[model samples]
Target: MITFNRVRSSILKAKDHRRQLLGIHETDVLRASIAEAPHFRALLSEIQAEAERARREPAPELSFTDFHLFAAQGTRIEYEKPYFERRGRLLALALEAWLHPEQKDLDALQNEIWMLCNEYSWALPAHLPYTLEGVASSRVTMPEVVDLFASETAHALAETLYLLEGRLNPWVVHRVREEIERRIFRPMFDTPNTFPWESSTNNWSAVCGGAVGMAALLLVDDRERLAGMTDRVIRAMGSFLEGYEDDGCCAEGVGYWNYGFGYYVYFAEMLYEFTNGKLNLLQGDKIRRIASFPAAVALTAPLYVNFSDCSETYVPNTGLVSRLHRRLGQPVPEMTAVPSLHADHCYRFPHTVRNLLWTDASLLHQPAAEGTFTFPDTAWIIDKHRLAGGLFAFAAKGGHNDEPHNHNDLGHFILHAAGETLLSDLGAGVYTRDYFREGRYTYLHNASEGHSVPLINGLPQAADREHEAAVLKQEVAPDSRLVYSLDLTGAYPKNSGLRSYIRTFEWSGQAEREEAHLRVNDSFTFAEAVNGVEEFFISLQRPILSPGSVTWRGQTGEVKLTYDADTFSAEAEVIESLDHGSHPLTVHRLRLRAGRVPGEASWSFLFTARAL
Candidate 1:
């Protein structure tokens, strides 16, 4: 275990104690580091073929016209997608050449880097110079933009220089270094107020700060300047921590947790390595609890709490989870060994590099965690069980409608059986300029109606911090069961006459048989009678709707939902959302509507999914 104390002692006892560097001190060491990795050489042919394909490709060019398009029209996919696609090729070829000199493609690497330097700005066209209203603004001084992609690009350039300094052209090297100073260092250290991301409390803070800090460590040799940068970074990281509640619940959902918090770990590891144990940011009660978040949300394998604009199935990042476990002793969430090297995204470069560099290969042998966990601060519950037939899991959340990356999904829940999503959350909608700038909540996934919650008076849930849920109580039993209740009065409009909505979930698993059951009881009270109340339970399978029950069958087996006929009526609609362009998915919105009536109502349902 690489504990803080051991690292500190090792640093003190070392002969030289020079700042640690990856494959930079010696070429042989670099070669060995790559050679020992099982993936390095095996991925060589794959990277080379990718390089050949990239060489044959036309270089992507972004003009002021592309920049102006987003400003004029809310269309980001046209320019941003191609822009990122181009970056993917550049990074892949560059890393390939540096990692293997025996089959190096120096010309390709240099060509890509030169083109990268020539781009108008590493920042996305949308992020170039814009007001909060999404209109393009004039930049008089150094651009104060610190976006996710731009920051990572800076670090990638700096780290590339650090590794292949002598091989690169002197003039090109000078240009890259000068650009880094002008674009990032000066704007960050000399005039930080010009940059807005430093104080951000979301993924922006961790990602932007981490990327800039990596560049500082790789390029800035002056201790005082480096110290100043680290100081500002510490401040920004505090804001990132503050973004989560005491429950360590990531309101951005686990996807951004993998994104925002992932960068937090990436940079934290880099700092620890550079400082030689003097600064171990991983040592803290909050950090440890924060590290345990994935375990709390993991339902069997890929399924998770897709609260906000997250996906129904979140792929596990094994390298990151392993590193977190080693550092904080958090259990490794269920994960498969998938290579993260060649993923094509701007935010992926720094992380992919670090994933290859920092991961502990031994953690791959660890088994997926099995248990039940709850976070009371955010009112999230996850229960995973290894039953007689297969895996039985369930997860849900009741938080504010106005969380970062939030959907108005208060009192939302998900049920999984045998690695199958029986009850689902549609996660995110397709990304468009309108998705962010226009009516975000107007979309089904962004609206309260998109989740497994009540559609009171045929109205969706409202947005903002004031709309939230109160966790009344919770219980996790040793008999393989969990129960929790939430009061969702503030999740809707006051005029909706929502006095209090108490939604309870009780999950129980059978040890001797291959069966798991959940009882959802919704007891609601209103100040005045309204049109009607419709309860929604979104599912991937087409539910057979009836008078007071619905059922769905899939690979996981049959899931039968039986409710009170006197209180509600059931209906199913096939809702198709095109948020993920090529992979436009569909869901069955099983609605249970109550007739317009009195001030109080009670809805009860028993959900059981059995494995055969």
Candidate 2:
């Protein structure tokens, strides 16, 4: 479980060390920008309207409401915790207090706010507490509440606070600087782990912890500590980056990519801002390339197979795209709604329609696609469309188990055919409750059934020793053949005789025919205690259709497709039994496993044709 003391100590030390090394003071760049932005001006107007509504409306009668009871036993609250929900409501009231000082019930509002806070304090474990209210409230204060509430919450809250007030809050400035110093300078210093909440590669521990360290540097108050923390966070981020093959696929699925990749972008943005454009996170081009992740899902329409936990069928957050656009210094034409906690006000149809319109408009202007590029451990091939045609993209992973959101899927690729995605990678699932952490459905996040290579043993690559693994080498040949060499040979330490493993994806495409070729190769060293094995599997999915003949080539999985207009049907899958029953929705997953683990093995999938 994560501990507050560890987090507090690390943050404090980093802050102190930063002060000694940077010889600088807090600078309020983000705070001032937020105050002045046109977007913020619009947001303020919205807040004022809500405040007016709350005032004109009769105040609800107060009672000794059992906040915990509401969270635990209440049928409505049982589905979702009331702690964060009530906190959001309370923060809204507080904002009303801040905006309209003339309200005679200022004391009442403050009292109610404190009561809500106290309730959260009681609901959460001692280590975690409520920090900030929500968007309308102060971002800086939220981090404090997070830190005070729980270690994980604190880390997340700290990151947001660091972004909002590194220059404004003396406490934050000092704390960040101090923590950096302790973690960086102290030889034995280690970062805090998620307590109460188990530490996972996809959770608040790795992603949020890394963000906190990166944000510390922006305050300009703790140079020494910031340097140390920066070193650790960057290395961690680097390790995560190395895990992706060129295709920009994440094994934890789209949900995890959002969690892990979201923070990755957050930290990169902080670094870019703090360095005054000196250290560009986009310099490596790896993070920017991840843009394809959202693009992949977006391009695959109708089915919108975002299968996992309780995640929405369609993503509600477009703010991320907007943020990315800002980072890339380009306009994100199609953005509908930003993620929100409030269910009632969250989904905006206008924004959604606008995004769809923008997508259609952008597709009209085809830009010349570029060549394949290789990052530390990944390879990417972009099929840009200058006109209206298929845009095929591929990402091959060659990184280690230690990569952030790393999964066992090393050779996953997402395919965009015609104007739609024929083969795709499912994004993410829901985050509320323990859904994001535990649940056997967690296997949904493993590499086996994901859009990549699956090991027969059903063990995840980063299931153990998650932080230290790495991709020792990777190579992408001019012939479009991609090879990834990993050190996971030692992933199963109990079977130590395992030496090395290699996964290769060779891609060949005929631009004129819109057909592509995929060749997969796996090589592994045998361990005395364990038998070597190999498996070849591929998952092919198209939007829900009826009575369709899904044909494939016997040699290299070749496909010739034809759809009857009369047989077309649009249906969705309901999670009842294990298989789809006569429903219009159908998903076909084929697995070919070889019990023998050869020192070297190869398999291939060739796409020779396409049918709309």
lDDT of 2 at 327: 51
- Deviation in Å, model 2, residue 565 alpha carbon: 27
Compared with the true structure, all predictions reach lDDT values of 0.73, 0.39
Tens digits of per-residue lDDT, candidate 1, 358-470, equal 56667664444677777777777788777765677788788787677778888888887776778988878777667775588888888888789987766678898898888
TM-score of each: 0.91, 0.49
Best by TM-score: 1
**Per-residue alpha-carbon lDDT of model 2 for 1-612, expressed as tens digits?**
113344334444432333312112332443344346543454445545654554455434323343223333322233124344333344344443433434555443334333432332321322222222332453222223222123222232233233233222354335434543332223212435322212333434436444454435544354445555665555556555654555565544455565567656656655554544444456545555665554543322222223222121344234445556555643332233322223222211112211221122222222323345444533222332211244443444443343444344444454444434444444332222332234423544333354345443544333433423346445556764454444445444443345665555455555655565444445565544344343323334432322433343322223433333232222322221121111132334433344444444443334333433
lDDT score of residue 484 within candidate 2: 45
Worst 10 residues of 2 by lDDT: 574-583
Let me know the TM-score candidate 2 reaches against the reference structure.
Answer: 0.49
The C-alpha RMSD in Å for every predicted model, in order, reads: 3.8, 11.8
